[model samples]
Target: MTEPAGETPIFERIGGAATVDRLVDRFYDRMDSLPEASGIRAMHAPDLGPVREVLKRYLGEWLGGPPLYSAERGHPRLRQRHLHIPIGAAERDAWLLCMQGALEETVADPQLRAGIYDAMARLADWMRNIPEDGRDQAAP
Candidate 1:
């Protein structure tokens, strides 16, 4: 399907479904193997397969390829969906670290990589539910 006003979607620019698949695979691989990511990685199920598929679909739709994610799972209330997990500065940083590596490994275009990383950094920061000082916001 054509994107509105003839602008090519980021998904197409970034090489479509194949690239998206590779990106997600690398992202999870880093999370699974990086010592610095252990804390955040522990938040995931022992088997990464399911989450990997979810991310691929979510990212594909987010990058404007197809609405596969929302079509199957409805709205992606990401923050709400992650509320059960406690995220702070460290968690956000770790997540970004994995994402940065994945982007560098998958996206050859520097400008496109920077844009995607910046947006992802914002999303990661927004997912933080705990303060940098380690205080839980949900606590009194």
Candidate 2:
């Protein structure tokens, strides 16, 4: 919420739209390759085209950049949108793995990257809908 002097926003500090795009690209790339991410990946379509752009726009606004996502899609309602997906601890951790890996490669600032990781981990956890009680997960 409060950025230090000359720090600008997280969005701007990370090079704005271009950086977000690259991060998203790397995130999906990791998901495509990471075995642990297979469950989360199965939640998506065979192609990542539509979700890719949506994530870019969503991250753009989420990091305090332009309101591209809100303008186009109204409120993000992240948890509501993701409730349909079975995002228990494992799924959340897998998602974070891809994102944290992507951030490591894309963001040069270690502190900033850590901050993003911390925030995103919490958000991802909050997206959990199904209980993680060894119950059978719903089909994606």
Candidate 3:
């Protein structure tokens, strides 16, 4: 997508790699502490170090920074990669909750933060593999 000024990327607007790091760290911190995030947290390994790095790389590239994540691991195929996990409406909401908090804590610009959150919410929603209640969800 095109960014403002057609020059600065979202990555640079948000403070580049440093901000990405803080965002991911704060995200995990929230997932680890927020009671609402317990379900999603249970999906992760006891040691979050590896996943932390993976997310950092993923976000870095996603935000228009570097291509580290793609260079190491081809196309993200996010949904396919997470097909094994059972994410429903509640789980998606929980993940968004942690991400929202992290974005609020790390991003200074309100509009920029909201934009990022909107995109993330869409991605998180797409990762849901299980259906909630009476809704029918297509498998990945």
TM-scores, all models, native as reference: 0.91, 0.89, 0.92
- Residues 60-117, model 3: lDDT tens digits: 9999998999999999998889888888899999999999999999999999999999
Give the residue spans of candidate 2 off by over 4 A.
1-7, 133-140
User: Per-residue alpha-carbon lDDT of model 2 for 1-140, expressed as tens digits?
Assistant: 23667778999988889999999999999999999999989989999999999999999888888899999999998777876676788888899999999999999999999999888987877677766766534435
Q: TM-score of the candidate numbered 1?
A: 0.91
List of clashing residue pairs for candidate 3: none
- Please give the lDDT score for candidate 1: 0.91
Global Cα lDDT for candidate 3: 0.91
lDDT of 1 at 14: 91
Q: What is the C-alpha RMSD of each candidate to the true structure, in Å?
A: 3.3, 4.2, 2.0
Native-to-model Cα distance after best TM-score fit, residue 31 in candidate 1, in Å = 0.6
Q: Model 3 misses residue 70 by how many Å?
A: 0.3
